[model samples]
Target: MQKYWILSLALCSAPLVSAQSLMVTSFDSIAYVNSHNGIQASAHISVKNTSASVKDYRLLRSRIGTTGLVDSNYFCWDLCYPIWVNQSQGTVTIAPGATANDFSGYAYVRDTSANGQDSIWYTFVNTSDANDSLQVMVVYAFNRYVSNSESSLPLLSVYPQPALAGQRIYGIPTDALKLEWMDLAGRVHQVITQNDGSITAPSAQGIWILRAYFQNGIRTTRVLLR
Candidate 1:
């Protein structure tokens, strides 16, 4: 179920008019697991204001879910907390031709839930002088189950196909898969145990190749991380 909060005009700034507007240009989501609890997210938010009047907004409130896993490393997952509101909101005033390009954050399940024992959900709400509201939802999980047996054996996908500078490498596997990341000169960087995942390229800036291996001696294409 979805939730929301409404504000009265008296609560807003006097200079903010009703004509201010907001436009969402992009939205996306992703899921994965690292050393402990897994996280599923929908991020990558970009917005614009097309209204004639100036717009001011603040990300003031948020809702987060919890997992009951009680492993010894429970505290390690706090880094996954969602706090974009505290970092991005403050007197964010935008002019008629102005824009905000980057808006993103993460929410994850803590190591307190029994395996396969919980459903996670969170919603972030923002407020602006124009009374505009933006809400985003994130879900975290351990693993995904599929009922379809007719799907292909399994596949891996790497994004930004050509690769670019200062960009994180994004990858996803279609089925249960294990991955090995290697550098061009035959060095094993790190092994990814999860299906849907991402890794940063070598910081020095050069062409690097990633070879992902799966069970049954099957191998996917080599990716260029530049």
Candidate 2:
């Protein structure tokens, strides 16, 4: 999806090399994203064969760091693999100078208690030669914060009606599940969780619409920042 392109390539970059065969395109060079937990977030990308000869390509996954808080992450090329599997189970044939956009990545976070963030590298390799490969890196983020713009319940209270930017506001709910600061149009600007006892105002000056999530329902309040 286009969301994937928006979050791409600062995490993964490589200098030019000779005899390139595989090239990945149509997605951001580096990407970062924040999505809801317990649901699958997917990104689709295309690969082209820059070589003059036909190339059989297979997908592979390489992790740069630990997979913390993420329940499972997988990729699909010719076939979708289970979470325990890292590479494609099958291969796809690409003609010389042809491109294919059949690669999709999936990630799932099973709970909201812990925030999940994973950086993964996906590569397309020539089946005949391991040296011929193209790789891209993407960062997936899912935090304990959840957003509900339509809740009518009074979830949390803002201590100061007129607070300064970056000022911490108290009176958070005891049973609060998550917190988000949004604009009047309901666009989330910042996310605050239990680790952050009270949410702080952003540097932007305006009427900050603070929303809180709870077991029963969501609540909303407003705080003016100078």
Candidate 3:
């Protein structure tokens, strides 16, 4: 039998305005665990005010969920907690054309089974205007293997350590379905399909993360771009 668990966050109030001008600069969509002890999943999210004026916003509310376990009460003993911001009350101001310093949320889950699932969500609203807001959510799948011998996924490798601007390739499983290249800022620079099979480094020289999606699971690795 397989077990499932969930952790989530929600907004306490709805935005007053019908239109939102805030944009999420970057986000992470997947997390994983390989043991019964569980793991913490987090993402640094950045927001920008495209509007001409400054905007005031705050993290309104949050929630966490866990399910399909023998002891639900065990999660409360420090394994789970709510998302938070650096500000006093999760409030901040963003100037036009400027990006807010990274804000992040994290969740921890422990699974006794080989397979488990969880999720996290965050809601931000414009306190001054009500119309400008952003919601960030990430889903996590936990995999617990008895031993390294039980794993069958092929190793994923990226070549040209410190790849040049125009030369890069990911040595992935033949069954790979999609590839995503993301920069440090969390912006997705490119998406490649199996038909294309092209791996191009970002224009800027720095560190980048590559995500490979296969029929069985997903793999993420970092590479340096020269």
Candidate 4:
């Protein structure tokens, strides 16, 4: 039987409105969450800046999920903090009473497999000064069904979250398998032979599902490109 864990994509709004150099104003439209070994989840993100001064900042997005009855938390964001790993970075200047949108990359969650609740968190950093301040926006997505494909025997892997045209994905164990690229409309667009365990994603917009089949079985995963 394929193990399906239910996760809730709950949206809780909190404002880090303070006298800091950086702040996380809001997060919206987070979905298609994925996890592996009951540990991590990754997805797309949108960020807005709300702070005083011409804030030169970066946005880091990450997820911390449940592990068992006891959950494990892994983070992929902008700063190399104790709780999260830095994934991507960009500089934006937030004018007083102005906001900036960051749609740069993927938010990865690590070690999220506990059959409990999970939370997605974001951090804003002021890159202009090392001594500058930071803020966090943590939202919990509850009652989600984690897929069997995410933690299958073959251990498939994908890369460059917020993937581009040129990035590579690997971890399939053999050849003689087929790769299919499908859209949400139930249409298959690209089919390529799986060779040397990995393949490059096409240069396209929106979300794509990649499926692979081997002598043993089949597995599927998701990627986002913009």
Candidate 5:
């Protein structure tokens, strides 16, 4: 069976009298099924300037473990920067107390092994001085198992089709492994893994996707909130 591995890393710059400090505020993990074509994951990285002065920084370098791989092409926020094989990207300046979001891109794993571990490291440096920098690293591991012969997944049920505010929706299903709720933007809203098969609707009025992972595969259903 196919499985996904996810890891998140948060880094804050060192405190120096003359140097500007930046902290990673929205770093999250992503996962996808491994296939012969390739294993891919989409991630969003963001940082905020916590210092008193404006700071100019550049993505100095990025390194991926031998087991995992990332392509040179990536989509950035202000611009679409192309990453070379050496893993170098463009630069940006952040105002004091301001945040830079939109470091979104795709990561890939070429190896289709049964089990393995890999890591990705991203280093950012001050444009003025190379000595001032910060590094963030993410480690991930995954294992694949034999797929079950059954072709159909277990039936899943959710109560109160149009869930109301402050209402907890009960999800009923057999042999459930995990459940995750995410908004349309792909941001994870909530996760439940005890196999109790219950989730609470978010206060926002919009459409959300509920994904239920089982031993064999995954099932997704759309949920609406009022």
Candidate 6:
């Protein structure tokens, strides 16, 4: 289907040319990250040439299906490439029995307001072989993201895409059950069980999902604040 095709393309943009002639020493599968720090997370994965001959290896990044949870991530072989660049433009030739510690994988949390885990894979491929390669799974365990139910709720009318200063409410009935302001991960930032059609926006300055509890269900919409 169209959905799967898009995911397949997002996995790895480079053509397949890899083998297991190289030995990749794996690191901790999980990388813990704090979204509140607003810092980039990185993992060090070392590779060694296991074959008798000098092995040339290329590093590739693969973000497939629901595996990508971070805003952006990439790998570093000889150099670091942008997230858009799936494969390294250069390859490193490792002498037999020699290990290369120059490989490192990185990920970022652009949305500090929301907290959730993300995963990305780094693969070291032998440029000359067809069945030789090694992969590292870096699961960024974020202590911070969006709820499926809240995202699927009916859209409510909230003014200002990038809401300037303070908090304002509009189109919401004062008699509603209650109003709740939350982030994409369903973390409640502010809540008002009673108010005069007004809600407070968190100072985090990003897209936030706002909702109101109704008798039957709930209505939700996203707001951006300065």
Candidate 3 residue 20 C-alpha distance from true site, Å: 1.7
- Model 2: residues with Cα > 4 Å off, grouped in runs: 1-19, 29-38, 144-226
Q: Candidate 3 — which pairs collide?
A: 6-65, 8-63, 9-63
* lDDT per residue as tens, model 2, 72-135: 6666578656556777768999999998876766555455464546666777778898887777
**Which residue pairs come into collision in candidate 1?**
29-42, 67-113, 68-112, 68-113, 69-111, 69-112, 69-113
Number of the candidate with higher TM-score, 3 or 6 = 6
Tens digits of lDDT, candidate 5, 61-170: 36666743443223333343444433334578888899876354444444556355455565667777777666666544433542312337665558788788557887
TM of each candidate vs. truth: 0.36, 0.53, 0.44, 0.37, 0.47, 0.52
Which ranges in model 6 have alpha carbons more than 4 Å from their true place?
A: 1-19, 64-68, 144-226
Model 6, residue 177: distance off in Å is: 61
Top candidate, metric lDDT: 2
For residue 192, give model 3's deviation from the true position in Å: 40
Q: Pick the candidate with the highest TM-score.
A: 2
lDDT of 1 at 28: 30
Q: If both were scored by TM-score, which would come out higher, candidate 1 or candidate 3?
A: 3
Please rank every candidate by TM-score, starting with the best.
2, 6, 5, 3, 4, 1
Candidate 3, position 37, lDDT:
41
Residue pairs in collision within model 5: 1-145
Candidate 1 runs further than 4 Å off: 1-20, 29-42, 66-89, 112-130, 144-226
Q: Model 3 segments beyond 4 Å from truth? A: 1-19, 36-38, 66-88, 112-114, 146-226
lDDT of 3: 0.51
Candidate 5 achieves a global lDDT of 0.56
Tens-digit lDDT track for model 4 on 164-224? Answer: 7646755545653777675533245677884777777767778776656666444556667
lDDT against the true structure, per candidate, is 0.39, 0.62, 0.51, 0.47, 0.56, 0.58
Sliding window of 10 residues with minimal summed lDDT for model 4: 73-82
